[model samples]
Target: MRITAAVLEQIDTQTVPHRITLEQIELDDPRDDEVLVRVISCGVCGTDRGCLHGVEPYPTPGVLGHEAAGVVEAVGRNVTRVHNGDRVMIGFPFCGRCYRCLRGEQRYCEKNRDLTFSGYRLDGSGGMRRRNGEELAGRFFQQSSWATHTVALEQQLARVPDSIELEMAGPYGCSISTGAGTVLNELRPEPGTSLAVFGAGNVGLAAVMAARLTSVEHIIVIDKVPERLALARELGATHTFHASSDTVEEIKELTRHRLDYAIEATNGANLVADAVAALGMRGTCAVVGGSSPSAKVTLKHADLLGHGKRLIGVMGGGGQTPAFLESLMALQGQGRFPLEKLVRFYDFADVNRAIDDSDAGITIKPILRMPA
Candidate 1:
């Protein structure tokens, strides 16, 4: 089958428009622990932008996308949890043998990282390729969801309720998961805690909303974007600080000189310092953004010496797969959380345009709709 796709040919390069031609490709029956999906909507995540624009490193001419949701077209023989026609979200498939997978942290899957980051198969075979039958270096972060149809490992697929709109369910793959999981799984803010989120983008706003759901009394959102700040307030932020303003002072004034936990979702290293300074004793600051290869952040040893403040780096929000996503959907269903306002839809061919909108802060989350 030939499909329209956006292919990143190299680092610091743009995704070239190409028809991904496949030979010997099969929608073959799922293996004992695999599933096939017809992807309907895939969100354009920051990582997807990075890969297309070359911030993080992945193989060239690769299909790089992670946030995806679709309907199941087939199920493996051993699969019983879900059947054909189920709605699902997919990520990279991880081998369950490693210590990370055993600990329920499948994001750090040992085998798939090489397969995922390298844009090749576990056996080093390229999944997407050129019309000449030469490999195009694909399999990014596992599902390579920038396509209309996808084959997902059962381990990485989440069965979402059919009542949910396909577009609304796509972002749970990365943006929403990163924010919600950072609070619920990593930081796990306690009742009456004070929380601050830097850079009120999709991830940061999600964190702010999650903080409101918790007993966290003070939710401070920091961002240079006025519209985003307004949206944050609408989503339950107790206070919003304009980054152009004296944000640190504003947070201090709102917090009575202390912050319990802070999540960093920006590229500015100084924002990290501000988050650290705003914390009280025994505070936790979770850094969830991916910086450039040369990007660095500094901390005062004295802050940790006696204050017992901890700064933690979280990858994929340190969450357990499927469970975190399911929990969020359930909350949304109960009307306790509404994440639909964050997304904007676009045609699949507008991949570059969507990235530009996300970069310009014109759109919070962009979902590219494939032709049905």
Candidate 2:
């Protein structure tokens, strides 16, 4: 099928910048284990920007949009979970046969790196190509959904409840789930505990909202942007702080050096040390941010070992299941989650402008609405 897609012709950098442009591409038919979807909306995530700016790895001439929601147009012969005409959100892909996957930890699937960044399927086949017969990397997160249509594995989709607007559900596939899941599924903070979130971006604010649903008493948010900090307060943060030299000290003072939990979602601000430093004795810090492949963090040894503080890395919110995504959608329907507050819609043709706004902090979450 011929489809319109925003193709990343090459990586963008200061010396040699490139922009994603809409181009007509050929899409392959669904494979035996895949399903075809006509995407209605897709979220522009920081990870997508990371790839565009050369901070993350993605092959050139590729389509890139993982947080997608749409109706199933067709299904492969073996697909049984969903049928044509069903509304669904594309989730992170995982090889269901991996040991971690069998243990209900699909986020850590053995082939996660390949499934997410390799651009092609594990079998070396891509789902899209140029009009000139050139292959384009299209299997990003197993669903390169920047295009009007996409083919993804059967396991990478979750039904979107009828009560929820499909356009508002795409971010739940990645950023929203990553932040909320880290708290609801992984942290599960005890009653009356204090939690601090670093970086009040989409992910961190999502954490703030999720904490409100929990027994967490104090939710502290830190960010350089005053507007984001104010928005964090509106989203349920009990306290908000400007990112500065004394930010950790302020958290320590507020929590009396007994901060129960902390989450680092700075998207490569390298705030892991500060997040860890803000923790109290035996406190745990969840690092859920994306960074360049070569980016590394250095933490004080005693801050972790001596205080018994734990620094754990969470990928895509620990473990993603269809049920988890549905629960979030249900919450949104009940006005409890309020994901709409963080969203702004854009036309699919303004893909680059949407991305630019997100990069400029002018937009919290940009959902590109595809043409019907």
Candidate 3:
């Protein structure tokens, strides 16, 4: 079956529309441990924006999206985790046998960077591109979900509850997971802890929502956008500060001159300095934003030494866990997380526009739905 998809023929190039209908590219029917998914909903994430503008998988004519959710159309012989027809949200494929994966942190899988970005299949033949041999890189993050159908390792895809709408839950694959995992897995803030999160975009908001579930009493969010600041307050931030306003002093006053942990969601280098300065003793600041390669961030050494501040860089919210995803789904169901509200729907045809809107900060989360 041939399908239409958003194709980027070159890095740093605009998404090009394909008029020549291309048929589906098949894998050798999965590798005994693989499952095939008919992707119904895929989110245009920040990573896709970065990649589209030339970051990971530098070469172009690429299939960019990684946050995909769909039904399991088929599976290989050794695929015990899921059978055909099961709905799933694909995660980053982890080796499962690596030290990091053994520790239940698949996002940090020893080979995660290369595995997700290499633009080649483990065996070398990509399952994308035109049947005529144009060669589009598939299996990006092990699932080039920008297309209608995607092949995934059974290990990376998570089966979701039938009660939840798969389309609305797509952001959980990356954006939500990154935010929730940082607080739930890394910070684990105790009651009365003061935490400051810089940047109130999708990832920052996810952290805000997840932070509300924790005992952390004061959640302060900072962003340049006034609308995002207001949204953060609605999402669960105890205090909100506009980056355009008096930031550092306001944060100091909000924390009464001390802080517990600072989650840096902005790529700005100076905000890192501010987060470190706002911390009390034994503080941790986790950097979770996706910035361009040219972006450089610098922090002071004194801030680290004087207060025992720890800076940790996180990936995929410390790797998606069933428990975390389930909890996020449950929260969304309860109307607590309200992730759906963050999304603006776009027809599959406007994927390029949606990406543009996302970069322009016009849409919180742009979900591209296949034509009905």
Candidate 4:
């Protein structure tokens, strides 16, 4: 089938910049374990921008979206999880046979790197190509949903509740889930504990919202953006701080050097050390940010070993099951999780503009709505 897609012709750089182009592409039919979807909306995540700006590795002439929500169009012979016309949101792909997957840790699947960034399916086959039949990398996260239509593994989808708007469901596939899941599923902070979040971007703000649902006593947010800090306060943060050299000191002072938990969600700002430094004895810090492949962090040895502070990395918020996504949808429906406050919609044709706005911090979460 012919479909319209936003294709990244090449990686962007300081010397030579390239922008994603809208073009007509050919999409392959669903395979035995795949399902075809007509995407209604897709979120522009940090990972997508990382690839666009050459911070991450992804082959050129490829499609890039992963956070997609849409209606099912067709299903392959073996697919029984969903049917045509069913609403769904695409989630991270995992090889079901991996040891981690068997242990219910699909987010850490052995083939996660390949399934997400390899561009081609595990068998080296691709789902999209140029009009002239040139192969393009389109299987990003198994659902390269920047296009109007996408083919993805049936297992990588979660049903969207009827009460939730399709446009608001896409972020649950990645960013939102990453922040919220890190708290709800991984940390599960004890009652009356204090938690600090670094970087009040989409992910950090999501953490603030999730923390609101917990018994966390104090929620402190740190960011250089004043507007984001204010918004974080509105989203349930008990305290907000401007990112500065003394930010960690402020957190230490506020928590009396006994901060119970901290989350680092800065998109490659290298705030791990600060997050760890803000912790108290035996405190745990969850690092859930997207950074360059070569990026590394530095932490004081004593702050870790001496204080017994733990620094853990979380991917896509630990383990994202369909039920978890549904629960979030239910929360949104009940007005408990106001995801709408973070979103701003854009027409699919304005893809570049949406990216620009997100980069400029003019938009919190940008969702591109596909043409009807």
TM-score of each: 0.91, 0.98, 0.92, 0.99
Residues 38-156, candidate 1, lDDT per residue (tens digit)?
87889988877766556667766567778888899877788777778888887546777898889888767667558467776576755565666666655676677777766666777
lDDT of 3 by residue, 111-206 (tens): 877668877666766766666767777768878777777778888877777767988867888888898889888888988888899988888899
Per-model C-alpha lDDT, please?
0.75, 0.93, 0.78, 0.93
Model 3 lDDT-worst window of ten: 17-26
Model 1 misplacement above 4 A:
13-32, 76-80, 267-270
Candidate 2 overall lDDT versus native: 0.93
- Candidate 1 clashes: the total is 3
Give me candidate 1's TM-score against the actual structure: 0.91
In candidate 4, what are the lDDT values of residues 208-325, reduced to their tens digit? 9999999999999999998998899899999999999999999999999999999999988978889999999999999998777688888889998999999999999986566688
- What candidate 2 gets wrong by more than 4 Å, as runs, is none
Ranking by TM-score: 4, 2, 3, 1
What's the distance in Å from true for residue 231, model 2? 1.2
Clashing pairs in 2: none
